[model samples]
Target: MVTDTAFTWSDAKRECRNMGGVLGVPSSDEENKFIGQLADGVVWIDCNDLEEEGRWKCREVNVEVAYRNWMSGEPNDVDDEDYQQCFTFMYDDSSCPESWHYWGNSCYKITETALTWSDAINECENLGGVLAAPSSDQENEFIAQLVPDDWTWIDCNDLEVEGIWKCRDDNVEVAYRNWFYGEPNNAIEEDCAALAVATWGNK
Candidate 1:
């Protein structure tokens, strides 16, 4: 059954226990979809990876999830604080915390205070995220909307090795780039990447 009241994952689990039921752990795609539809937004499931970094299990059922439907780029372990260890689902997949914007199954927020590129990354990590890493034109545009009139730092950088751009989140080579002509010229040996009005450059 769906409940309208919002609660943290653990609190929701405890609430269910108080009612003589356990938190839901969908065992199939159809069941998962049904629960998502019923809840409408941000329902906590029994899945989590606290015992192991990449191994997920449903604590209520005490078994590995038989079916998984993580949104793309999910389970990224947002940061060290919360670790994003628990799972959440939304019917239309657009729910986010207050002050954050949702897009493509991820949440984003522009920092209120100006920061340098490296400092921005640290701040995001502190808040359970890396700097934004737009992998497509549409995603890029979405992030652009966050700071329309100002430049913003992103996850792209060549810090591992000069001239080799990579996404800091996973150390993977960045597959998409929007460098302006002659930009990323390593002017002053800058190794960080930033986005401006529809263009990318080194910082």
Candidate 2:
């Protein structure tokens, strides 16, 4: 789905990702015409030539585009004006920094910056992702390796119904939980979840 908010190519991709989607990829002439009509300004579709110039592919997926509707004389490889690599539209996936470890189909950007639950989540959102969500033992183990002794903002919270935690990304109540020793007492002010420091390693 295309967003109404105007953003740079990178920002647009990130925004759609946070919403669990990729930018729309119009795969046909009819679809392209429809999108062009639906848009007010230039709406980014899923066309990009990131890997190879002039060899375009739909950003929403990795495979090469089966059809193209580029305007005539468009994509003129106008160099020197600036580096225009990724296209103005459509969804593509990701590759996190080397510092980020990949596990269970997701990249974990573990950092030491301390922030409140809300602020932490916001920071993550700005980075094109959400606070980490661990729904299984394997995923939890990955988190454990990254944060064994210190707290980190996780995706579980009782924000919807105190004492009933849920995953912020999916809005589904958690069926598995890993609370600290004598924790989650529903402290009048505590609605968020954190990984309690187990051994105090990096602080």
Per-model TM-score, in order, reads 0.52, 0.47
Which pairs clash inside model 2?
23-91, 44-88, 44-89, 45-89, 45-90, 46-90, 59-91, 60-91, 149-197, 149-198
- Candidate 1 local lDDT, residue 46: 78
Q: Best by TM-score, which number?
A: 1
How accurate locally is residue 74 in candidate 1, as Cα lDDT from 0 to 100? Answer: 80
Which lDDT values do the candidates have, in the order given?
0.72, 0.61
List all candidate RMSDs to the true structure.
15.0, 15.5
Clash number by candidate, in order: 0, 10
Q: Candidate 2 lDDT, tens digit per residue, 111-202?
A: 66878888988888887778876665545655765777667778777777766767645455456666665677765678877764421111
